[model samples]
Target: MATKPRMHLALDFSWTQVETDWRQPTSWVNRFYPDIGLFEDVARICERGLFDLIFFGDSTGIPNTWEGRIDAAVRRGVAWPRMDMSPWITAMSRVTSHVGFGLTYASTFMHPYYTARLLNALDHVTNGRIAFNVITSQRKADFQNYGYDELVEHGERYDRMEEFVDVCKKLWASVDPDAFVWDPVSGIVADPAKVRPINHVGRFFKVKGPLSVPPSPQGRPVLVQAGGSPRGVRASARFVDHVFGAGKGLALMAEQRVKLDEALRAEGRDPQQVGILWATKVIVAETEAEALRLKERLIADVPMEAVGAWLSHNTGFDMSTLPPRFSLRALNQRIVAANASPVGFVGLLAEQYGEDMEISRDEFFRHGLHAATGYASTKAGTPVQIADYLEEMFEATGSRGGFMLGHSQAGHRAVLQNITTMLVPALQRRGRMRTAYEGRTLRENLAAS
Candidate 1:
C-alpha cells in the first residue's frame, strides 16, 4: 500500500514583528497590543485553515548585545517588551477548539515543579490543546535576569535541560489517570493510593512530590523543541514529540531531520513517530506576478540594521562591529568561547554548508549579515505554486511533518490573511492539507497528520 501524504502546518506567533516593522500598518498597532481579541481573531483564522498550532517563540531579556547597548533594540523595538504567551493562549483556547498553542518556556531559569503545575493547568484550560516549546536559553542577558553572571556553556545547558525535563516528566506522571474517584456516596474525590510523590533527584533539579493538578485530556501536553546543536538534538530526541526545526532550505531541513532520526534510533525510538516541522516564510497571492512583486517589495524593505540587531539577539555576538574584512575563525571562536549566541554562527554555517567546507570571512559576512532579511527558502507565487512547493518539499523530506509559516516583517498580517484565504484552500483542493481537524486535542491532530 502507498503511504498517505499530509502536511502539519503551524504559525509563528511573536511580538517582534509588530515592534520592528515600522512602515506598514501593523496588526498589533491597529488592533492594540496585549489585546485578547487580536489573538482570538488570529486563532479563529488558524482554526479555519486547519493549522495544527500557533507557536509563540519567546526570550527573557531586552537584548543589549549590539555594540554593547540596549538602545538599538529599544529604538527598533527588536525583541523587547515580550508579553507572556500564557494569557493570550488561554483566551485563544476559549475561542477556538481544534488549533493548538505552542508556548515556549525556558528550562534554564524555571523550576520543574512550577513548570509542571503551570502547563498542567494550561492543558486543562485549553482542553488538552497545548504544546510546550522547550528551550535551553543561551542569551547572557537572560541569564543576568535570573541572577546568573554568565550564560552556561552549550553542552551544560542541554545537560540541565535533560534533567529539568526528566523532573517535569516524573511530576506529570505522579498522578494516575484513574486516580479521580468522584464517588459521592463513598465521599471520595480521588484515590489517595493512586496519587504519589515522584521524589526525583537529578544533577540539575530535585523535586519531591506529585503535581498539584491532574493530567488533562491528552494525558500530558505534546512536547515541542527547537534545538539545533548536537547536544540539543540529542535532548530533543530523548524528550520532544514535535521538533520545530531551526535550519532553513530543503537540504538544511533534510540534514536536521536525518540527525534527529539518528538520535531517535539511539534512544530506541521510531523516527516516523516524531514530527519535524521546518521553519519557512511564504507569500501567496491570486496571481504569480503579484506574489513576485510583493516578495521583491518585502525583501527590498528589509532593513540591514534590523537584520543586524536580530542577529545580535540570536547569536549573542554583536554583528555591527565586524569590519568589511574580518576572520571567520575569529568570529566563531568568540561566539563559541564567550557563549555569546544561543545558536552558534559556526553551527548555522555548518547546517547551511558542510561542516568541513572552508568559508572565507567575506563569504560568512555576506551570508550572515543579510541572511535573515532574505527569504531564500520562501514559497512565493500563486496559491497553486505555493501548494506545489509544499507537496514537493513534503515528499522530498520523507513525506511527513510540514512547515511552520513565518513572515519577514512584524505583525505578519498580510501573510496570515493570504495563507488563510488563498494558500490553505489551494492545499486542501489538492488533498495535501486538511480541510477539517482530525481530532479534538493537539496531540491527536499532530498524530493524525
Candidate 2:
C-alpha cells in the first residue's frame, strides 16, 4: 500500500493570547505574561502533541499610528510590553526536546553578524531545533525606534533583506562545520586550515572575518521568511527553507503556491523541496456549537479604540482619520503611498470584499473588530470538523506544506489543550499526522515524509 500523505503542524504563539484575549475568563495570560513557567508549559504541551515548531513574531515599537499617539495602544496593551523572547525561548527549550523554536528579527534594522551569531548559539542551546525568521520591518513605529525618520522604501527593504541573508550565510559558512577538533594530546581546539575569514562587502552592509561562535548543530539555523508582496515573495524564494504565509482562503493560498514555485524555479531551486506553512487560526471544542460560542469571545468586550489602534498599527495607516465611507481600492492606494505594507489586513479585505466596493465607516469598524480580534479568519468546530477543514486546505494548497495554527484563540489553556489533546488525536487517527517524532533535528523533521 502507498504511504498516506501527512501534514506538518506548528503552533504560533506570537499573538495567540494577546489582543485582549488575556482578559478572557479562560485565559491565564493576564497572570502569566512574563512568567517563564507559562511558556515552559506551552512547550511541554506542543512537544506532547509532536508539533514541529513554536513560533514567536516580534516588533520593537509601540503603536502610535492610530491618532498619532501611543495612548490607545499602551492603555489597551495593543502591542506593548513585549519581551525580547530569546531568553524566554531558551527557557522553553530546556523543558522540551523535539519541538523547534522560531525566533524573529528584523533584517532591516538589525546587523547580520549579530543575528547570525545569536542564532548559532540558540541552535546549540535548542539542540538543533532553531529556525530563524527574518523580516523587513515595515512599520513606521519600528523605523522610528531604530533611528529612522521614515520607513525604508519597499523594494529596497527586500533588496537589503536578500543581501542580509547572503551575508549571514557566508558568516555561517566561514568556519567549516567540521572545523572543531578537540585534541587533548595535541592541545589544538580547532583545525587552523578549516577556519577562514568572510570578507563580505555588499549594497546593504560590509563585514569582515569569521563568526566567533562554533558551527551550530544544524550547520546553521533553518532559514524562514514571511514576505507576502511580490518583491517579498521573490526574496523568500532566494533563501528561505520554508515560508510563513497568510491563509486568506483556498484560492489565494493556491495562487501563492504557484507564484512561489515560479520564483523558486527562477532561483534554480527545487520548488518541491520548499514548503509554505500558512498562518492559520483554529479553535477546537467538544462540539461545533460549543466551539462557535468560544469563538465569539475573540471580539467580546474589545473596545473600538483598541480596534482602531490595532488596525492602524498593522496597516501603518491612521484609522482615526478614516473618511465616513471609502472604497478598499482607494484605501489600499493611500496605504501604499505612505510606503506601508500593501498586503496586510487592507489587502485581505480588498480580496474578500471587492476592492471597488465602498463601505461605511461603521461597516469598516465592524470588519476591523473582527480583523483586530482575529475573529474573521478563525475556524471553530469539533476536532473532526477542524481536521476536515485542515485536510481540505492541505490538499487544495498542493499538500507540500501544512498549517501554523494559532494567533486567534489559543491563548486560553482550555483552547490550547483542545488542540493538543483533541484536534491532534483526530488527525493522528486519520493517518494525517505523526504519532512520534522521526527526526532529531527540526530541519530533518520538516523534511520527513
Candidate 3:
C-alpha cells in the first residue's frame, strides 16, 4: 500500500492574544504580558504535540494610521506593545529539544548583515532549529520608525528585498562550514583559506567581509516569506524555501500554489521541494457547539474604532477617511497610490466581494469586524471535524505544504491545549500528522514532511 500523505504543522504566536480575546475572562495575558513562564508552557505543549515550528510575526511601530493618531491602537492594544521575542525564543528553546523557531524581520528597513549574523547565532543556540521570516514592511507606522517620511514604492520594496536576501546569502556563505578547527596543539582556531570577504555592494546595502561567526547547523537558516501579490510571488520564488500563504479560501489558495509553481519554474527551482504553509485560524473543542461558542467571543464588545485602527494600520490607508459608500476597486487604487501593500486586507476584500461592488461604511465595518478579529476565516469544530477540514484543504492545495495554525482567541490557553492534546492525537491516529520528530534540524524535518 502507498504511504499515507502527511502534513506539517506550525503554531503562530505573532499576535499572541493581542486581539480582543485578551479581554476575555479565559485570557491570562492581561496579567502576564511578558512572563517567560507563559511562553515556556506553550513551548512544552507544542513539543508534546510534535509541532514543527512556533512562529512569531513582528512589527516595530505602533499603529498611527487611524485618524492620524496612535491613541486608538494603543488604547485597544491592537498590534501595539510587541516585544522583540528573540530572547523569548531563546528561553523557549531551552525547554524543548525538537521544535523549531521562526523569527520575522523587515527587509525594507533592517540591514542585511545584522539580520544574517543574528539568525546565524540563533541557529547555533537552537541547535540548527531556526527559520528566518523576512518581510517588506508596508505600514506607515513602520516606515516612520525607520526614519522614512513615506512608504517606499510597492515594486521598489520587493526590489530592495531581493537585494537584501542576496547580500544575506553571500554573507552566510562567506565563511565555509569547515572553517573552524580548534587545534590546541598548533594554537590555531580556523583556517584563513576557508574564510574570505564577501565585499558585496548592492543597490540596497553594502557589506564587507566574512561574518565573524562559525558556520551554523543547516549551514543557513530555512528562509520563509509571505508575499501574495504577483510581484511578491516572484520575489518569493527567487529565494524562499517555503511560503507563508494567506488562507483566504480553497480556490484562492490553489490559485496561489499554481502561480508560485510557475514562478518557481521561471527561476529554475522545483516547486515540489518548496511548501506553502497556509496561515489558518482554528478553534477546536470536543464538540462543535463548544467550539462555536468560543468563536463568538471574537467579535464580542469590539468597538468600531478598534476595527478601524487595525484595518488602517494593515492596509496603510486611513479608514477614518473612507467615504460613506465606496467600491473596493476605488479604495484599493487609492491605497496603491499611497504606496501601501496592494494585496493586504483590501486586496483580499476585492477577491472575496467583487471589486466594483459598492459598500456602505457601516457594512464595511461589519466586514472589518470579522477580518480584524480573524473571525471570517476561523474554522471551529471538534477534533475529527477540524481534521477533516484540514485534510480536504491539504489535498486541495496540492498536498505539498501544510497549515500554520494561528490562535483565533489569543489568550485562550484551553484552546491551545485542546489543539495539542486532542486535535493532534486525532490527526496522528489517521497518519496525517508526524508521530515523532524525524530530523535534528528544522530544514531536515520539513524535508521529511
Error of 2 at 153 (Å): 0.9
Clashing pairs in 3: 17-410
> Model 2: clashing residue pairs?
none
Candidate 2 lDDT, 237-261, residue by residue in tens: 9999999999899999999999999
Give Cα-based local distance difference scores for all models.
0.77, 0.89, 0.91
Candidate 1 lDDT: 0.77
lDDT by residue (tens digit), candidate 1, 89-135: 99999999899999999999999899888898899999999898889
The numbered model that scores best in lDDT is: 3
In angstroms, the error of model 3 at 205 is 1.3
lDDT of 3 by residue, 321-411 (tens): 9999999999888998899876867888888889999999999999999998889999999999999999999999998879899868446
How much is 3 displaced in model 2, in angstroms? 1.4
The Cα RMSD in angstroms, rounded to one decimal, for candidate 3 relative to the true structure is 0.9
